[model samples]
Target: MTDHTTTPPFDAADHLPDELIERIRARAARHDAENTFPHDDLDDLRSAGYLGILVPQDRGGAGLGVAEAAILQQRLAGASPATALAVNMHLVWTGVAKVLRDRGIDDLAFVQEGAAAGEVFAFGISEAGNDLVLFGSDTDAAPLPDGGYAFTGTKIFTSLSPAWTHLGLHGLDTSSPDGPRLVYAFVPRSAESEGTIEVRDDWDTLGMRATQSRTTVLSGAVAPADRVVRFVPPGPNPDPLVFGIFSVFEVLLASVYTGIARRALDVAVATAGARTSKKTGKTYAQDPDIRWHIADMALAYDALPPQIASLAADVDALADHGARWFSLLAGLKHRATATAKRVVDDAMLVAGGSSYFTRSELSRLYRDVLAGAFHPSDPESAHATLASAWLGPIES
Candidate 1:
């Protein structure tokens, strides 16, 4: 519980109270054990106005930017990665809305207002074999007479499936007047809106089990005419939707994994200090090699928070990084995930056989960190992006 109110990574004030985080941490293992969503955590967060951290202050939220949100998420993830990961989807959408609104685009105003009013949003962008990421989609957005759309496709790894009030998604509209438009919109998931957003019970996995990010099947889900937000031509149309989602998603995602690294390092340090070596009749912490490992873990973990904060602040300032923002953000994500994996591995080794057990916290962290590599802007994509930035886009 670290008295987060006083010792927060950022001066979060009274927003991220210490008690709320402790309660969230207490339930994480149980939720992981039961293979269930941390509804109570969500409830506490919702009540504490966490779900609306990115919603506009004018709209009854804290009205913070991505930098502060990154700090909050890192703190939360250090306590409970699954809860932080599950909530990341919601923050991504709200952050997207904030990014758009800051750019003088009022289209996603509904998202901000909805979030402030307690509407939960889940990101529904990832599709199987769709490495094109935001640049493409397998979902079909069939146009309607009333200007709405009927989206028919499966959205995988949709976190907060069991409780999301709105699902933000995009689909390819090939038959549009503009021809091959990538339509983006939000689909509701009320009881009356069941068929529109079906939550499939198929989220059994290794780490981050409590996220319950089930496979969502959209059997002709409808996003009303008003809900229809963008209709840009496909294949990297540099739209706000693209930039907003990409920046927020990758940044927040990176923040979560970085926090995992922080926790892992802390655990390793504690274990090292406590475990006395039988060989030298001294503590492992006193061993030069062990101290070196801890030093390496700190060295690796320290670089990420500043990077996240700096880039996130750039996002808040709406800094024009031109084509560089993509590579920078993607690189930050890639680095964070990679660093997290490396730190966790070092920590596991430093902890010795105790960490090998399935029930160990380090073991849980090992599995959770594995997922960081699988998120958007993956390793290969990030390298390609970075290469293009350093050299040039692959010869047309």
Candidate 2:
């Protein structure tokens, strides 16, 4: 571990160094094939301080916002979606910590230390049964004899569990028996004294295989009262900006999907220019149909980023209006995710059968892009949220 403290500062927009890009590109296949975490590539991110991009500056982090983080994720995913997906959990949880700080959590020092040290973190929100609710989880916490309640339940798709140092556990508080109370606890990943935590190696998926999004079971996991953040009451309440900030996660996800599509288009265009067809002895690029397909790919690739950028700018500007801002945020996510899926599908068609080959980079991009639409802030859920907002309380 060489000292990265004194390294010359680099711009995030330089599109990641060639060495790092080569490293991620080289391991993309192995990580996907073995369904293993991309530790080596993440090491590269740690060394470059890319992992701390979203950490606050006061906490020794780069203090970049969603915009810069989105750019970084897109560039990384352009080369390796699995590696990008694996690291995204940390960024999201760090954002949550920031939000907590705004609510007076006062634990900025610890967060900064962890970010500076490149500590890994995971968001444990999704559950097997409550997947439709997006933010809902099956785990619950209750008041214990000493005040802190025991957290119990299983969480599905706990990404980056293998390398995480902090677990952002989301669960309902059973102590409030009248209604479910949402609570988020920042627990040490190593705190399972009884060894009740179990990670299932059952995440066999079509894309982003290196994410290591397996299941984790926790039985009577004791959590301290202080470790648990304040409970969120059930209802359409809170500062609307809270939900708006969450929508930024979807934008980051969409950026990655768009980057994958861009990469696929790049490969298709370059290949089409050189490879000659058998019948005409002419390059595929000269064929009228192939050229038209290439044009369509180029058009799509050029169009999506501006839309994402505009949406992000809108969210940033609406920092005051809570409900309206949240609605726009959800709408942006709905559009971006849907468009990303369409763009990648077009990329695959342009690349032809070669894109389907196991070794083809385009094949991996296609798979990962498709996987993007199924993430938590998915297009369908975003649309439903938007519709609910439009219809008022009656729709729910």
Q: Using TM-score, give the best candidate's number.
A: 1
Q: Which tens-of-lDDT digit does each residue in 244-309 have in candidate 1?
A: 999999899999999899989989999998999999999999999999999999899888888998
**What's the lDDT for residue 334 in model 1?**
99
Question: How far off is residue 230 in model 1, in Å?
Answer: 1.0
The parts of candidate 1 lying over 4 Å away from their true place are 1-10
**Model 1, residue 38: what's the lDDT?**
90
Residue-wise C-alpha lDDT for candidate 2, range 81-190, written one tens digit per residue = 88887787777766555555554555434555687788887767678767444345578676677766567888877888678776667677756767777776666667
Error (Å) of candidate 2 at residue 73 is 0.4
The C-alpha TM-scores of every prediction are 0.96, 0.87
Deviation of model 2 at 141, angstroms: 0.7
Q: Root-mean-square deviation of each candidate, in angstroms?
A: 2.0, 4.7
